[model samples]
Target: MRIIFSLFLVLSVSTIFSQEIETVQDSAIVKVDSLYREDQFYLGLTYNTLQQKPQGVSQNKFSVGLSAGFLRDMPINKDRTHAIATGLGFTFNNYVQNLAITGTGEMPFYTVLDDKTVFNKNKFTQLLVDLPIEFRWRTSTYESYKFWRIYGGVKFSYVLYNRSLYTDDQSKVVITNNIDFNKLLYGIYLSAGYNTVNVYAYYGLNPIFKSAEVGGENIKMKAFNVGIIFYVL
Candidate 1:
């Protein structure tokens, strides 16, 4: 009877010890997983256009944009579903339009080319350094690699380099770093979707050029962009 009682006690203690060790291991795993983050790096491609264009100005060819960046995500809640992110990025933008810039100085000539005017190429390109601040919300967890997300933000850009080129049968005109362009630009943007693909849009709050005139008309054209963006861990 004594031997049986001792064996039963030993078995009970061993079972309790095993359960305690498992509980500690599970707790450690949960604590580590709760600190996971999402969408640290991003790449995007956009179709670029002009908004609030002058009466006769129109886009020509394909105006394209490319952007890439990394974001530092800071979770505001315990679940980490909501976050605020800020990052630095670079953008390359090309605007092919009927507007012609003819000179390379502080006071350059601006013209809105009519459809009858034939030109081989007329476009302006910009390289900008972008700073983005955004609010992020996602249905994401450590175990779920795919989820839905919505991110909205305002971006500030500083133009690093700019060029305008026009070519035709008669002559070729090129302008570099024209002072009329707004060196500092700001815009609002939004992105939303699931998994790896998201739709993105941006609307510039200010004009692309400052004190730029076309036929005695003040040029107040803003930029508009729409495209797809991808996020990666």
Candidate 2:
């Protein structure tokens, strides 16, 4: 389903640009056509980390994930160096967590792990779709492809899928719920680099769970991601 969605997004962007090419007489369009490339798709792979997860929920430092999607870059002024990049994107994140969740509806919380809690594996994953609005500035001409650029923005996402897993010596426990998770997530991101390889970083602005409790105390966790962004233009 995700692969299909990505294809649809790419095709939709290509179709839009094709329509614009037919109607607009701007030199930028002509230059873009001459380049024989589309500059609207972005793909990223990132490392995920937990911030403020229940006091003792240990995590692997390098839990990683990926995201891909399309963007529309709309120039803001006559110089055309500054623009707003807005689009839909899909993201998947995985965290290697050691803390176990043991919460109910009214009051949700997590338990800390001690030396006695031996485990082979434990992880949490989430799939989401986001809308990003960015302020973009680039040093590029219609015919130039290798240029320095900076893009920073806020993104809002809806969680489409989520799962948790726990495994020990003999048994595996999979959890779809325990903590009361928020369906919506919002964050800010920044991407900057020359050419196609850009550095990407994101920080969540809201908690992962809604009014949840940990060891009888209200606790919240936010996510942070940093990685490389690839622009297939």
Evaluated with lDDT, which candidate comes out highest?
Answer: 1
Per residue, candidate 1 scores C-alpha lDDT tens digits across 44-72 of: 99999999998899986789999999999
Model 2 misplaced regions, further than 4 Å: 1-38, 102-109, 177-179
lDDT of 2 by residue, 1-233 (tens): 99999999999999999988877756555334432323489999998988886666777556998999999878776656788878899999888877665333334335666668887777778889999999988887767778888989999999887776767888776667434777899999999999999999999999877766657766678989999999876
Q: On a 0 to 100 scale, what is the lDDT of residue 224 in model 1? A: 96
Q: For model 1, which pairs clash? A: none
Roughly what TM-score does model 1 have, to 2 decimal places? 0.86
lDDT (C-alpha) at residue 113 in model 2? 63
- Model 1 residue runs over 4 Å out of place are 1-32
